[model samples]
Target: MPPRYSYWTIILNGTATSFRSATRDELIPTLYQLKKLDPKAVLKWFARGRLWESPSEARAAAQQRRSRTRTGAKETSRDRNWRPGGTHRDPKARTAERKKVTRGHRTNSERGRPKGGKVH
Candidate 1:
């Protein structure tokens, strides 16, 4: 069958998933029928392309996004809360944060380490 609506971003059980649906009002029942969510569950949508598992999650996501745009900070505690086995603070990504890890790299001797002491 043809799509009932353009598209919808859905957040359920602390995760974000999307599908085409007729409208927000019709999406819930469709979710229920599809076995994607419980019929009594409620989702909060911050905008057309954003959905959250809860109102608080929605607020937190929005706040994080706003802070990123406002201060241009390189990183934030809120932004790295979700990573595969991490907490459900973010619904979009399930991988490690986008920072480089110095797994086996050697550091210059003059950077801040004692000559013979292990670096933190």
Candidate 2:
């Protein structure tokens, strides 16, 4: 059986084309071929919470999603030692750290008191 991974559908010259259990890597070349054969061919795939109308769009969204979720290669030593709101802060650097620190219930101290007494 072919890898049951990414699924795609293409409409070209009024003919609908699809494959069974085809992986993303397998379908990418087909997408390029279809595009070359007919520029009007529509490539559709389910990705990023919606149906993407083109392979390029799907690939860009997938790449962005991967970059957000994946870690390490983009990091520098400064990033590892950085803190939120600090002089060396880089928002993307300590995302997980910031999330961890902000998780769970917040206390009055953490929220900071008003200048005067409590509000009515």
Q: For each candidate, what is the lDDT?
A: 0.54, 0.63
lDDT of 1 at 87: 61
Reference-based TM-score of each model:
0.27, 0.28
Residues 55-100, candidate 2, lDDT per residue (tens digit)?
5788998798688668645544454756656586665757876876
What is the TM-score of candidate 2? 0.28
Clashing residue pairs in candidate 1 (N, C-alpha, C atoms within 3 angstroms) = none
Query: By how many angstroms RMSD does model 1 differ from the true structure?
Result: 15.6
lDDT of 2 at 110: 64
Q: In candidate 1, what are the lDDT values of residues 1-120, reduced to their tens digit?
A: 764322444545656556444356767665666454354444444443555444466667778878887887655454545555546566533333332233444455746677877877
The runs of at least 3 residues in candidate 1 whose Cα sits more than 4 Å from the true structure, single-residue gaps closed, are 1-18, 36-51, 54-59, 76-120
Evaluated against the true structure, the overall lDDT of model 2 is 0.63
